[model samples]
Target: MPTPVILEDLQAAFPGWCIWRSSAGRLWATRNGRHLSQHEVDHGLCRTIDADDVAQLAEQLKEQETAEQAL
Candidate 1:
């Protein structure tokens, strides 16, 4: 499972997505109001990543959110 800090950061960054870990220790995500699976995100969106990459994504998302809010 991801640490609390990483989990909180991701949740805040991706408010419209569901991010979680599976029992097998794999990360998964699904957009809110969508029936997409982790596999779909990986193959279709080409967003397969590890924990470190997730942190980077969180930072990017945070910046985008901030910019959107400022506009």
Candidate 2:
């Protein structure tokens, strides 16, 4: 799949996140509205997550989703 399609899929898969690619080609995602708390951050949540490719970004997003659910 193409980058744009992958980005769209990611955006759809993680509705609470805004996903995009930088000019330098790094994939990034940030939460749409609410911010993570310090406790969440300390427990491994992040304000923003970046990955070199779609798969890694997806995996990270899934992990974040799990972390959010655990809260």
Q: Candidate 1: lDDT over CA atoms?
A: 0.54
Q: Candidate 2 on 5-69: residue-level lDDT in tens? A: 48889898889999999999999999999787899998889889999999899989988989888
Off by over 4 Å in 2: 1-5
**Lowest lDDT 10-mer window, candidate 1?**
43-52
On a 0 to 100 scale, what is the lDDT of residue 56 in model 2? 90
Q: Give model 2's TM-score versus the native structure.
A: 0.89
Q: Per-candidate RMSD vs. true structure?
A: 7.7, 3.3
Instruction: Go through the candidates in order and give each one's C-alpha lDDT.
Output: 0.54, 0.87
lDDT of 1 by residue, 1-71 (tens): 23236666777657776677667766555556745456554443423233345655565445444544554
Deviation in Å, model 2, residue 52 alpha carbon: 0.5
